[model samples]
Target: MRSLVLEDFGRLTLHHEEEPHPPAGCVAVAVAYSGICGTDIHGYTGSNGRRRSGQVMGHEASGVVLSTAADVVGVSIGDRVVINPLVGCGACGACLRGQAQQCPDQSVIGVTPSSPGAYADVVIVPAGNLVALPAALSLRLAALVEPLAVAVHAIELGRPQRGEVVAVLGGGPIGQSVVLALSVLEPQARVLISEPNADRRRLCTDLGALPFDPGSTGAGAPTDLVIDAVGHPATYAAALSTTRRGSRTVVIGLHSQQVTIDAFALTTGERSLHGSYCYTPTDLRRAVDVLTTRPQQAATLVSTVVSPEESAATFDWLASPAPPAGKVLICFTDTNEPVAAHR
Candidate 1:
């Protein structure tokens, strides 16, 4: 088996490795399509942490189950599925309360060592994390369920009502997902996206969102809800200013660096800002359904795909300060086909 591993900070490579076997309660998936997530980029650049010599580097993934334990009742061998990467300690207070992502003992598969990741030919995931992919869903498209779940969680946190105006302040994968989920759920709401990238700006427009350049105009109009998808210091400030008095703002993006928000703004206008993290199983189910049902929109979200051998260069391109688009898929199957090779 061949796998892409983060050898160290600023380095990734494709190398031959052994395929994993299913453990007592685990399942082994022959990865078909895996996404190069923003977190993977952060891991590579040492933003998350210095890579542990050879760790598999993928979490957003969909694949066919090569094998599963007999105890796994709902799913079986050869079943196509999408992985919900967060693994929680079911005994914790948060987990007991059904908030697994916030559990003190929770750990992500690709980020933490207790579970390896999807970059390999065979990746082992707990049976609990597997969600069966719908028949109509493309394997490539189904891989997007994780990020879409993140967006769905954000919308639920903000609780935006119909007819309200909302602004999403980033055009990356998570930001795009926020726009998609919000638009689909609240059809009447006015959705705007603040993105500096031209290609991503166009994508936002194509997805039925009003694209605004944050650098030029900070959403000249008052918004009812603001989703900070970038979570950078500057965008945090913009998120505060874009919303109207008493409006709610949701912070969904992961910010590793220090970010400052004006305390006066929060107190003066009665504006509330909420932090949203990973979603529950319910959000994953909804995200999977949408990805399967809407093939056209799913195809548009994916900007590029690369084979395992090409993952290093492609990932480097994606990890740069400016990426062309939000989603980049990496196919682990031995097809030797580049996603945009024909172009």
Candidate 2:
């Protein structure tokens, strides 16, 4: 197996290594495609400080099952699946409630330093974390399930009403996913996207969202609901300031560690702000449904795909200023699994 290792904060080096075998209640997946997440770029740029050298840091991915331990009954060899990544101790209270992110001992496959990730030819995942893909969903588009799941969870938190106006505070992959979520789940709701980049704004517009410059006139006018996908202090303040009184706002981006909150803006308007990080089990399932049904909308977010050898340069480019508008995937071409771009 070939693994992409984080040799340093800003460098990723590929090395040949032995393939890992799955243990009890686990399965081995031959990776087809792995999406480079914003968190991965932040880690590569040494801005997140959550990733470290010698760690394998890919989480958004899809693959075909290679092998499974004896007790893995739900999935078998040759099944195409999306890696759920977030694993919880099933016996815990939070895990029992299906909120894995709140589990005291939860471990994300790529984020946890000890576990290998999908940046390699294969990844070892717990059987429970595998979401079996239907024949309708292609493996390439399936790599987006994780991030789309994040948007699904955020939308769930915001709970936008029918025909209400919703503003998304960025036009990156996650922001684009949020628009797609509304398109698939609640098409009646009008969506407005604030993005500085022309390409990103156009992508959102093609998805039936209105694109506006965040700094433009009338940009901060109150809307029924606002989702701050950028999560900077500026965007956080924008979310609060742009949402109408008694409206809801959800913050999903983690670009910065600390954001200064405006007590007056929040208190006077009586706006409710919600923090969303990852998806629950139900949200992940809906993400698969979203991709399986509205594949073309999901396909638009997959902007580029590169081979494993190109992973380093791809990471560098994404971490650089003004990266491409949408998602970039690292494809492991040697895998027998099909990696189709669209239906």
Candidate 3:
């Protein structure tokens, strides 16, 4: 079997590995497609890989189940499915509170805590993490469920009302997903995007958003809700200041450093800043529902598809600032499984 291993920081090599088998309560899946995400790129270039070497590096993926352990329930072999990347104990306080992303004992796929991930010919996941995909959904686009769930969680946290003005900062997959989710939920909301990439700006327009280049111009007028997909510390202040008083600003992107904000401003205006991380099962269910139930819309957002051999190069391109039309997918060349992009 072919698997992509993060041999070290700044290096990802494809190598042969034994086929994986399902353990008790787990299922073995033949990965059909996996998408390279920001977190994967971070592990590739940052300190994560150096500290946790040789981690199997993919999480956003979809595949067909080859087999399942005796204890695995709910899904069967030959089912097409998308893997939910979070592996958390369901009995914790956070889990009980529906905040599983904050579970004290959570482990994520492709990260330090979980076993090898979907950037392989075969991977095993707890049966519960497998969300069955609709037969009509292509494997390539189905892989986007993970990232799309993150955006869904962000919108869930923000709780925007229909017709409210919303701003999405950043134009990456997650950011674009936010735009799509918001548009779908609130068709009347004035959705705007702050992205510097010309290609991404065009994508925003295609999704029915007004584009504002943050680096070149001020984030248009104050928006009722602002979703910061680019959570870099440097951009926090600008994002915070551009929001309407009493409105909400959702922080969905990961920032590595301490970010300074106007505490006094927030206090005075009674505005709120909320941080949204990973998704729960409900979020995943909603994402899958949206993708499978609306294949046409899903296809429009899937821009590129590549073979596993091209996955590494795609990550490099995503890491560097490039024009992004939509999500880039890595698909198995030999499968009849659905690929999200146009033919």
The residue ranges of model 2 lying beyond 4 angstroms of the native Cα positions read 214-217, 334-343
Q: Between candidates 1 and 2, name the one with more favorable lDDT.
A: 2
C-alpha lDDT of all candidate models, in order: 0.81, 0.87, 0.78
lDDT by residue for model 2 (212-321), tens: 65566577456888888888989987777677899888999888888898889889989888999799978999999988888987888988999888889888889878
Q: Which lDDT tens digits does candidate 1 get at residues 267-287? A: 898999899988988889988
Roughly what TM-score does model 3 have, to 2 decimal places? 0.91
- TM-scores of the candidates are 0.93, 0.95, 0.91
Name the regions of candidate 3 deviating beyond 4 angstroms.
47-51, 213-221, 321-325, 337-343
Best by TM-score: 2
Weakest ten-residue segment in model 1 by summed lDDT: 334-343
